[model samples]
Target: MSKIRGMRRYGFLASSIGVTCAAGLALVPGVLAGAAAAAAPAAPATTAGAAPATGPVTGPAAVPGSTQSLPLAPRAAGRTRGRAVGAALEQGLRRADVRHFSLVGVVWDNPATELHGSVQIRTRSAATGTWSDWQDVDTHNTDHGADPGTAERTGGHIRGATAPLWVGDSDGVDLRVRADTGDRTDDTAAEPPVPLPSGLRLELVDPGDTPGEDGPQTDQPRTGDLSEAATAASAANSGLAPLGATEIPALDRADTERELLDLRGDELTDAQRAEPHIGARPRIVTRRGWGADESLRSPGFVYTKKAKAAFVHHTATGNNYRCSQTPSVIRSIYRYHVKSMGWRDIGYNFLVDKCGTVYEGRAGGVAKAVLGAHTMGFNSNSVGIAVIGTYSRSKPSSAAVKAVARLAAWKLGLYGMNPRGKTYLKSGGGNLYGKGKNVHLNVISGHRDGFATDCPGRKLYAKLGTIRSTAARYQGR
Candidate 1:
């Protein structure tokens, strides 16, 4: 799957689920937030007696990583190329010099609306002073979000967005987005170019400084008072590790069962208790280990009834980063999701760097059934694991694939699930299954299995059989 072929193959089914879309990124509280308050600036709290937005604003400005939202306007009518029918919502060759940023994406007013178009960007390297070729931003990204009709989906301020593209450290950029209004050329035709979604804004994300910048350790200690949300995130893993532990140590199979039985003994069946098939617990760096600004996400953790499946994904934020910068890259994506894309948190449940190091994602206990905003219609009752690179044409590193298996084996095992088996998950709405419908899926499936999009990418998707076999072996199946 060459990148070009991959882009050409990204066609959606006629009946994919859609949701309400809103624009802007203001900080709000409750089940889902920011929509009704998009007009407010991210910082300098004006919430009537609120204490001057001091530390780690989930609102953007208070954090080290920031998002620059530049509005997209209509291009001049005189432009000769890029009109599908008539001059639709086309941002033609807009260039700007801005603060340093490494990742970029485009967001629109409504989540239900699809940008049946093309998005391309080229950037001037901050270090090299040279321009890179135009890279296409994947348009088929609506599949990577919350299920339709959920509070997280309907939550105010949610917007339609393309996948964020990692461009490495760059200061100057050129952006262009054109809607595919079909191939009608006549200006007098009744149909117009399918206009791009409303409130379209180009978002450039600065992942911020290294973790050690403000502390002696890479797992920078939380600064200032912790938000109730951050506290809850830490408390979720109370029995697994000491309070405020930066990483959870791995345990052998026996110790893993002991810990699991200690934490959730009451729920295990007699058979499961007698013969636990759970794999050895793998070491996982916590959000704290990676210096996550916990306050950046809205103050709540949503969980499914029980986790039954693991959906694999690729960050699609590009492969320009090194393994050492994984934390920074994750932070940038976190900021982009919460502050830029208007979500409750970073979408994935866990993230794996190319070197196979796994990091906790979506601020919840690693062993819990934490709900994630990944896999769209299939988010409920499933875990999402995203490798930190685009894999359309590129082969996923062997280590990354193995990491997925190891994480899946232990996570699914917690619920007595067999990684190599099949499970039924009711559809929340997607091209493959409509809302409230039951659909059978492999216990370990790719993102595309739940929605019509090329995710986890082709190379990684192809490695699922291997991942499943490896995970099953780990569980002694």
Candidate 2:
């Protein structure tokens, strides 16, 4: 069983062009905000709307790795629409010759709570040729407005800054923007001019401090414990172990039949075979435990019971071994969760071993209501599945990944789980697994996100987007 954690919060704000400020405020410099923050909030726009179009828009190439500062002030007092400013910035970026980038804007409120502002850019392409259609990357709102002092200030001070936006595959363009309040009109014609760098240096900041060190300076107190925990967990769980040298028990032909029988009509033909390979055979059920009482203590425990969501996790234990074979390992995991870490049973409702064999953990038939201990708040409506190895560093075999996908598809069909079109991969503070803002499927996520331990590694988490995408494809069919 794998440990699960919560998600993080990242705040982004948009301001008019002509805002100027320092560059140390984008993200926590030297720190990767956690996986918790990596999960995007409900985006107001379509997921496909987040990225720029493939063709070129219009405008000169903005310098790579340079700040394009803008100065802005509301035409009327007490009226600050950050969205309008964000739109202008998006247009500006689209006009610039940068590609594959992350854009962020910050609005700083003074002691009296006036909307002073800043912005930053991190690009992975050089400035050349024409601009591409601007895509609004993900945005977040930190609790900076929660502070009475910072929230009450007025007088729209525009101080924008752009961090050294690195064009990873290109020469690394740099662009900057500084707010100039001299012109106070609502139109771009009255806005301040853009700043271009004479020459730029593509210096790489330590990945650790990239967030906090690069953006506009702020007095906002940092809460980074969750971020650190997410990072550690991701690091620990990444990568797959080499095929273990030890030979373990193989699934009997009869046992395979029994497992498939449980699925009824959904079982695949290949799913019945014990050894598709001659040398090694993967076992589906290594061990089975029954509680003292037959009524409530069936062969399996209910990890979660929900008809809508699917929770995915990696067995932090090594790959050469199957989790079913090691009941002690599962017991240790459960003890740590229930007694020490404070969770119900080992988080997952079902466990998948290295050989792509599925074992029942929390059990409830399709007819009877099944509940799981997988996701914290939503377990009552989810099916928790744990793959037996760390996939962050090691990729799950094609067969294993495919097996999990197929199982999820079957479960989704059986349970009537709607494709929420929201990917839960961005679980732990937005850092656990996957990439991008769009959630392709409803509630499909990795384990490290729900708790603090590194159950599923990075390499495995990266594939989550594909998994959900595939699920969506299947569901569409």
Candidate 3:
């Protein structure tokens, strides 16, 4: 995608983040005043030393490491009249000459404004001069993998950041945004006109060779030295051996009759290691198996005994990737979540590709309640399973849905949760549910059910019923 050739850039207005209430949109006190007071140094309209060009330039200059803010101006191509209220209006599109960048996203400074817009981008394929078709970028996204009620939401480089979409191996780029005006139910007579968001930006994340470029690299596991005594001690204390660390190679295995005989009780029991938590295990590529470089994430694992539910989500990183590129996609998301969003690790506990292959997401054992940063208010007891692409309007592949069922059956059954049943999760805040609020949700639910936004998309959400039923069947219900 390319940035618009020439447009007058303006420093966008930065608004403090507002709370979403049942009544309607409400601004936090002194938020606007504080934003207005500190207008200067908010953020420059464009990168310093990079001059605006007059026309579209084909080749891009090598940018060492930069997050340039390209201001988008309203274009006349947008339709207004007779347009349904609250529907997102395509504001404008901008293109820039960014050579060799792996990640792309839209950013703004208005936290007070609920900007619901979708970004579509077309990238110039390096292998060929031909351009790719425009793909959708989730605009209603607010999840930056930040811890609930934590300053990571309001602090760091993500205060007003929209979810960053991934576009691998691209030089040319173009982006467009449409502010969501639907779902508005305020008393217009009493409330003043809501201000539109400003300081529009396109953050390009180029972290070099998509970490683990030479395929997946094996490293030391999360646990310390893997010895007979150590394994027994850790297993006795933790109730579960660190076998999940197998793929990462934290410990070496020396097969011997004596060693095999010694492994009798310390290792995972045959029943505990079986799939479906009841029957044959489904195929799952571990984080190490999928080539995840654990070096990019924080150490230590957060767990909750057992998983009660599975929250489905879309990566929202665009759908321009191939099944073969799934590893790279996961790696990029891992980096963005840790380095950019400042989370402990990748948010989701598992990721399913369109091809139906399931990959382990956060580092903890697949069977444990490895608390994920997904589903803002309910990450603790739930496992977040993110399908790799946007499914708002697009239909999820049958294989993908089946993969979800297989995963839900295996994981949910670990705690004896029927996929078709209901479960209660205590909210951790950062969503429509109040913190400490106990919310009853479907055992298999979309991200929207817990939050107040559209996630897992309508298409994917619609498939939850089938997914649940299939998952139940997989559990031999």
Query: Looking at candidate 2, what is the lDDT of residue 190?
Result: 57
Model 1: lDDT equals 0.74
Better of 1 and 3 by TM-score: 1
Q: What do the candidate models score in CA lDDT, each in turn?
A: 0.74, 0.33, 0.57
**Ten residues in sequence with the least summed lDDT for candidate 2:** 237-246
User: Estimated TM-score per prediction?
Assistant: 0.82, 0.33, 0.64
Q: Quote model 3's TM-score.
A: 0.64
Superposed model 3: Cα runs more than 4 Å off: 1-97, 109-113, 116-120, 133-135, 143-147, 150-158, 178-199, 206-279
RMSD of 1: 11.7
- Residue 258 in candidate 3 has what lDDT? 18
Best by lDDT: 1
Clashes of each: 4, 124, 16
RMSD of each: 11.7, 22.6, 17.3
